[model samples]
Target: MSLKSLIQGQKPLTISIISFLLMLALVIVIGLFGGRHIIGYLEGQLVAHGIDHNQEVIAGMQPILERGLQDGAAVSVIVSNFQSFIEHAEPFGIRLFLVDRKAGRVLADSQNRAAFPYPLNQLLDSMPRQLNGAPIHDLANWDGNAWRRTASGSVELISLHDLVVPANREERWALGVSSDLSELLVLMDSLHLHLDVVLLITYGLIGLLGFLVLRWVGRRYEAGLEQQVAERTRELEQAQERLIDQARLATIGQTASVLAHEMRNPLASIKLALSGVSRSEGLADREKQRVDLVLGEVDRLEGMLSQTLDYVRPVVRDEQPVVLDDLLDKVLGLEEELLSEKKLRLVRSKCPQCPPLRMDREKMQQVLLNLLKNAQEASPDGGEIQVSLEADDKKLVLTITNQGPAPAQEVLDRACDFFFTTKARGTGLGLGLVKRVVEEHGGSVQLGSASGKVLVTIVLPTAD
Candidate 1:
């Protein structure tokens, strides 16, 4: 896939991986250059330490060798004495060498460490030239390194400030000591191994921490995005609900207009004519019964038309602050006889300190009465109907719960829809009208049915 799409598709996962990879690459780059610098520094330190160790061995031998040569002691004997001294004195792989340049011969050699082309790789000079060149002799001068091949065919890196011994007779002598570089090589190898371990651990920790932190940030970002999406979805659903209600009201108005102008007048005329005939004293009992049946059917049709027109009618409110508990008492009194006939029990609860709500008294009465009827109808004989009211500073809530067989989820969802009724003789517009009135008063309605109970809840604004 293209990079942008991959990043956008699973932003949290993809971005975390990318961040970790980039951090890993950065760590690797830093380790490479930093590791090189560390190793170079370590190598230089090892070499310097070896040189200092070799110089110490030379210092001890200098005084004894000069006195022995000037006192006419044999050069061979002096070389032997110093070699034994250093082997027991300084604990290192130090070798001593002496050459007779004038006799064109080796004077004394310890370990056969270096062969005749002496100082073959001489790299620096910092010692006395000779009395023959005139001027003062700088006794503490230090020379630089030299490379040589031993008779055994191995190579050694050697450093010595040339020690000029006084000439005895016609033979001139050169004396110095060299330290084998093998120890330096071994130290560098060990140092390199340690550096590798340190770099591995350092970068490994950085990669792990960087990945965890980056992943956490990405997840948090994704969570924020998800919350925003959910909020927008809720807003869209609310907008759609408003649009559907508007469309439904428009359709109902058109149908209501047709029924009022067309069928309502004819049905009224038919009912009036039938009533007049049925009242005629000349009619027999059989004729009177048939006329009354026709009139009854006419009355039913007219009732249906009136119900539809009422539901489709626009609401006009005379709003005032009304106490809900008193209204509820009167509505309950009207249904007392009906509740008694059905063997139903009424249960009421209200907040004692509840405030009055700003609403249309007539419209709210209709809403409460219709809800009470639904609760009464849904309950089995001897079952309970619970009416509850609660009030807060911002709003007032009313709830009615009826004991009944559990309803389907779809029924609860469309419970307040226009003309949606489960009753055999229902016009299906009762709850629809209730919802319209409540919404007109800037309130809301909710219906739920579950576990052998049906519940309806209404919320209205409190008085300003």
Candidate 2:
């Protein structure tokens, strides 16, 4: 279609729809990018603040620590300085502890008891490395959320900004401050939530504007489209008439039901008569054999009649649990003569764990019968037909595969659609019925052709 026609034909609302989608995408992209940058900036600030606070704690304790080491002061005097440091830095949430490096034991802690065993991964920096070398500047590690460890072995946060000391070369001790990074994270989180809210509001406004624009555009275009459709109605009817030229198919579904009721009584009588003849003692062995053959053919006719009736008069289900194996057996009984005539074998490898499923038994059996009959017809004369069942976390599956020349792709595409059939005398309602019944049972049916074989798969939800 030309761009002008596409814009003006049928619905003028297309313009607003396209514009709204573009604006919605833009809003999402902006929110995502904005949230990321806001979080990054907040993290950077938190890291900077954490590093500065550690520098102060290290500076204050440096002179006292060095004097204690040089003068060989008792642990009591060293701990006094530690307590003073903590008292001064209390607002910052800084805690200090002295460790015996060789023994890995705490000597004096700001809390008036031995420090808890340090977690190696949580350790930020080694005191020996800081003191034995040039004075260290700021260093910190993010412990995620509000927990951040600094160069000095202390825990603190932005609330303790006053305890931060300027970096000094004279400092000899290392400091670890566990800063509360929550303020930064909280700020970042707030920004993200705000951005999300803004995006939602933007989408709502855009949708409202687009709806108004479309309504206005539609009001302007509706009269013109109605006039055009009225003018071209005759031409469209001619095209449809040419397209669906098969008159017989157009009436098959409707006529099948009407003819079925009339045909069933004679089919049943023929089946019953053959059954009685087959049971009677034959005058000769050859006669008996012919009688059995007649009985078999009668059974096949009866089955065909059943399929027609089922198709013509479909029954909507009040679904109930059906034992799959039992249902399959009943369907197989209906198809036994056809299977025998073709010398086709039916093999079942059903998982023992497969539970019963909720379905319309008659409809489900009809589906199975249709699928198997199709398989039987498709296979090479005397070939095998395999029916396998398995279950997953949610659904039970059944697959029927037959060896034959796979169907052409073009024919396969519309195989399940109503009135689409491949056979010369086919009613086309068989697979269509199968599709409808499976769908009504909350299941799906699939047909695939591969490796010179046709496969039909039916997936049904497991029983409650």
Candidate 3:
């Protein structure tokens, strides 16, 4: 799969893990480059130091050769003396050679007397003319058998060719010194091994720390996205609820108008019959009293029917600017007696910053009264009821809470459904009407139960 597809298919934690692996690869690359640079730098220093040591050896051996030549000693005697010096030296791997410059032949060798005349022709053939009285250095590797059969390794070779005039003699000699560089190579190898271990540890630690940081940032990002999704879902649900409420209101309006028109005629005929019977002289007093009771029952039924029809009637809004706090005060004053009878404590919290809102005053009053009455009925005597109004830049929120036995989950779920109620005598249209009125005003209503209390929340958009 492509990288984008792989990443998209993974969870947040899995993405973090992938980032850690990439970081490890980066660390490996950095470690390799760093190790190579460090080893190269060390090898350069070792080679430079070896060249300087080889030049010093050439200087030290030149004086010995000059003294032997001034004394008229044979080349063999000089070679034997050099051999003796090499045997007593601390660094035994050094080799010295003395050669005749004109004839290009070895005159004395510290490594072997039998190797005299040992192909100085090749050594001189490659040497530069006009040495400027300074030594020339080069590096070469040799097999162990060629030298003293001791070891095979590389060496720094320093060659000096100059005209030397001993007393009563003029001769040209080329002096050469070979310094073993095996120890320097060994040191480089050791440094490389140690560097490898150190770089491995350093990269490992860095990779681990990077992984942890990525994991933390990934979790935080995931949490923020989740919160945003939840908030958006809530807003969409509120919008859907408002649409449903509007549709329900329209359906109820059409149905109730027809039903009420039909029921009114029958209710009027029943009232006329009861009135005629009560006035009849042929009837006994007990019968007349019975007619009176029937008339009272008819009036009660008529009142309930009228209320239901009124609830379903299409809302005619007389929109005006009204202060929310003032509106609440007026509604609470109207319910003073009922609240006092139940001994219910009323707590009010209002936001001072709430602006005037445009809505139908009479309809809004009805909505508030219905909700308060429900709260009062559900609350026990001496229970507390809380009413709070809060506002933000976009909306106004009102909440009414009453301390009481919570309603069943099923009842809460269908609280806004027409003719759905928990009370035995309730018509179940109160909350449905409230929901319709609120939705008509571009608002939403939510009913919930928690902690043995009923909560009703209303959210209304602020005036643009």
| Most accurate candidate by lDDT | 3
For each candidate, the alpha-carbon lDDT, in order, equals 0.73, 0.65, 0.75
The count of backbone overlaps in candidate 2 is 12
Q: Higher TM-score: candidate 1 or 2?
A: 1
| Model 1 TM-score on a 0 to 1 scale | 0.61
Candidate 2 residues 1-464, lDDT tens each? 99878777745456667766876677667766776787777767766677676666665666766666566655567656666666555566555544433233444445434354443223334322231234323223211112323454333342111122223322122333444555556666787788678767876687668667776777768877888887699778856753553343346545665556676677678878867876777447788788788877666656665565565454465466677877887888889899999898878886878787766777887788889889988988888889888888789889999999998888787898776888886757799778767866778898898888798999988744
Residue 96 miss distance in model 3 (angstroms):
5.6
- Worst 10-residue lDDT window for candidate 2 reads 158-167
Better-scoring candidate (lDDT), 1 or 3: 3
Q: In model 3, which regions exceed 4 Å deviation?
A: 1-37, 48-98, 107-151, 157-177, 208-320, 333-355, 358-360, 376-406, 417-419, 424-429, 433-464
Candidate 2, position 301, lDDT: 59
Q: After superposition, how far is residue 452 of candidate 2 from its true place, in Å?
A: 1.2
Winner of 1 and 2 under lDDT: 1
Scored by lDDT, model 3 comes in at 0.75
Clashing pairs in 3: none
Which candidate number would show the highest TM-score if scored against the true structure? 1
Error of 2 at 291 (Å): 16
